[model samples]
Target: MFGDPIENPKGWPRVELDEVLDGIDSGKSPVCLSRPATPGEWGVLKLSAVTYGRYNASENKALPEGTAPGQNLEVRPGDLLFSRKNTYSLVGAVVLVRETPKRMLLPDLIFRLRLGEPQMLTASYLHQLLMYPSKRKEVRSLAGGAAGSMPNISKGRLLKLRVEVPPMSLQEEYARVVERLEQHRRLIGAQLHCLEAGLDSLQATAFSARL
Candidate 1:
């Protein structure tokens, strides 16, 4: 029942990620016992940084000096981060770094990708591809473990992921479309949160009046 699909869409290129990328790496775990750092330092990003296909800076954790640099991994703006271990639905969640403070670090369970030619593969496109249902299924299948627990995708499997690349212009266009959709989703989410907060406040106020 599968329909015939175009092998290569016009203005698109068929290429694997390894072909156009350099230095695909993940972060190291911070030492829990490390001392705290002074003010004005870098923060460490956990899987919590990524949510619903976006980066949430509000939830990031600050790193102490011992885990800041020469002790922990460093990340930068424009780098792509992926969740390596999480709930089935959260696994493979991706985010594009929009800003970088000094000594930014990623936890061991997350991956950081540094693109060789940023023009060739836009971070937005990569994020979309990884979030695709088919790709997520593939990642889940590769995950090894017992049922009902967090599963992990090995480094070898991650590097071997096949990515279909579109031309830079088309990629940018797709990114814009995805971005618009994401904005709408975020708006809806905010509205829901506000509604929930209002309901909670009303309930509390009513209870207080009765008291």
Candidate 2:
């Protein structure tokens, strides 16, 4: 639910984060009662599961036998996750969930964003914007708590955070750019793996010769 919408300039539209998001809710905080789970067991997500630009569902540990996985705790693909509480630097760390394996429930410390209008802003574009260095710095500065322990951004502050919203067309273009960049990244990663293997073989041959 958005507050009173702000009028935009002639060209670029600006909106508070709440304007574009339908809801922001954290998950159940069940006590960690068991070790990390196998592939099919019910599990609880950890704060570490939400990394910048990535999600590791495997970071979750198994729930105890009697713990109830609360309603609305399941994190589906395409959900945007934010760390509401963590060390100052890690607070507000966000990630796009690309996949969910088996039954994984969202943990209390992580908040999920429910988009109000997908057409107005693609998830990719908003994700890129949030992870932008300037925004990240702003988020870190806003987080509040004790000196050494977990800092937190209140839900009110998060909703009030302002964001620039360009035209939908421009946002789509940016999404395409992100897609291409990801493709390029995967290609480069494969090439680097090959190069590393080649180097390892060369080192092995050199060691054999010395022997």
lDDT agreement of model 2 with the native: 0.79
Task: Give the alpha carbon lDDT tens digit for every residue of 78-189 in model 2.
Answer: 8889998887777888887765786888888998988895556788877877777777887777788777777888889998888777777777887788778877977998
Model 1 residue 150 distance off true place after TM-score fit, in angstroms: 2.5
Index of the highest-lDDT prediction = 2
- Each model's C-alpha lDDT? 0.68, 0.79
Which ranges in model 1 have alpha carbons more than 4 Å from their true place? 1-13, 32-39, 65-72, 100-102, 146-149, 176-211
**Per-residue lDDT of candidate 1, residues 17-50 (tens digit):** 6666786687766554333333476666657877
Candidate 2 lDDT for residue 39: 72
Give the Cα error of residue 71 in candidate 1, in Å: 8.2
Candidate 2 segments exceeding 4 Å error: 1-11, 183-211
